[model samples]
Target: MKFIGYQSLITIVCYLFFIFMSFWCIQDLHLERHLKMHEMQGKLLIVILSIVSGYLLSSFVLSLMDSLRDLIYIFKS
Candidate 1:
């Protein structure tokens, strides 16, 4: 079995954290009185945007790190 790198592990943790935050926001809405429809929709929108942006940023950073690692290996050889 091959070892999974730290970048992958950290990305997964961040994605999970985003999911947890979304749920927490929803729970907060439920706990509050006089819920407004627009307010809920706005919160959902924020969650969706955060997830998409986080995914894009994570992949970009991880790929850049991998390229740098490969370059280091090439120089060392």
Candidate 2:
């Protein structure tokens, strides 16, 4: 089996964390019986946006690291 690099591992972990957070937020919203409609909607939107933003940030970081690794490999070779 091939070893996964630290950047890839961190990216996967961040993605999973964001997914879990988004689902937990949705479950909380569903279970809250007293929240007004507008408030619930706002919270849902925030959670969704946060998950997307987090994923994007993680992806960007991963890509940057990959690029750096490639550059170093090229220079070494």
Q: What is the C-alpha lDDT of each candidate?
A: 0.63, 0.67
Top candidate (lDDT)? 2
Model 1 stretches astray by more than 4 angstroms: 5-8, 14-37
Poorly placed runs, candidate 2 (over 4 Å)? 5-8, 16-37
Model 1: per-residue Cα lDDT over 10-77, one tens digit each:
76886676556555555454432444456667666656655776666666766776798789887787
* Weakest ten-residue segment in model 2 by summed lDDT: 27-36
Candidate 2 residue lDDT tens string, 1-77: 23568656777897877666656655554533555456667667767766786677667767887798789877786
Cα deviation of 32, candidate 2, in Å? 16
Clashing pairs in 1: none
Error of 1 at 5 (Å): 7.0
Query: What is candidate 2's CA lDDT for residue 56?
Result: 72
